[model samples]
Target: MLRIRGTIGDLPVDLTLELDDGDWARLGSQLQPAPMADAPAAAVAPVKQRDDLWQSAQDLLRNAGQLSGLELLDQLEGLAGDASAAKRLLVRLRHSPKVNVASGGDTPLYSWISD
Candidate 1:
């Protein structure tokens, strides 16, 4: 049995899955690492786009020096063109070594850390 509990955007998700022996085997096989030689060339585009967005997000904070969580999220949503993507970028920023997260009353304050 597998349980997944999380939220997608404003939606809450609570999911459970039950698998038998055969299903487990199949899932395990699918989870195996693929060979580098078999990797799809077309998959690079999305990865490149994601990297660009990540860089852009970092730049946004660096330029601002500091911003409230809500302010940052709003700008990131505009930059990423999607709320979910923006939230994901924000989370990544929150955990980054170059950023500092501090509690600020009702929201967090994100500040860029200079090296």
Candidate 2:
């Protein structure tokens, strides 16, 4: 069973879905991965651990003193290789005890909350 409730623009939307055994099997089959050969083989680099991302984000904020969210996102994108990953990093930093956020014109400013 799944319940989805949200707003689309100003309109509210709600939905509920229940899947039986056959439905579950069909969904599972659709989610199966392609054969290995059909996939492109790229060199796999070491994954960046969460600790490293957190430390790097902290270092950036500490060194900058303060940065607008856009500026921080840009820097994080350079480090994380994509906007999505950078957004995740920004959210993590926003919740950290060592960081503080304040509105700065169009964008919020992030600063390191030092001990």
Candidate 3:
């Protein structure tokens, strides 16, 4: 038995398959990859595990058709200029980030002050 659920293009969907060899032959290219013994180890981490969260968040926001990046900043600017809330959000984002210095605040935010 195989269970799959997610979006296809702009449409959301779900599917389940219970198959024997003959049934699988019908699926051909559509059949998903076989599960391996290491599948448990491949389980994703939570929000604090930045990589997983970043991709997951992007996907969720994209699915919801929300504005990203520059727009996200513009929305936050409503709260304050150089806002403590924005800085705190960025700090937490950077601390558990997918890459080093994911946001401008990591260095450039402090550049003028230091120089």
* The candidate that achieves the highest lDDT relative to the unseen native structure: 1
Give per-residue CA lDDT, model 3, range 16-109, as digits (tens): 9789997777788567665655455436333235454344443433343433344444434443345554445444434532323324543322
lDDT, candidate 2, 10-48, per-residue tens: 999899999899999999999999785675544222333
Is 2 or 3 the stronger prediction by TM-score?
2
Clashing pairs in 3: none
Which of candidates 1 and 3 reaches a greater TM-score? 1
Clashes of 1: 0
lDDT of each model, Cα atoms only?
A: 0.97, 0.87, 0.46
Name the regions of candidate 3 deviating beyond 4 angstroms.
1-82, 102-115
Number of clashes in every candidate structure?
A: 0, 0, 0
Better of 2 and 3 by lDDT: 2
Error of 1 at 97 (Å): 0.8
Q: Of the pair 1 and 2, which is ahead by lDDT?
A: 1
Q: How high is the lDDT of residue 47 in model 1? A: 90
TM-score of the candidate numbered 2?
0.57
What does the lDDT come to for candidate 3?
0.46
Clashes of 2: 0
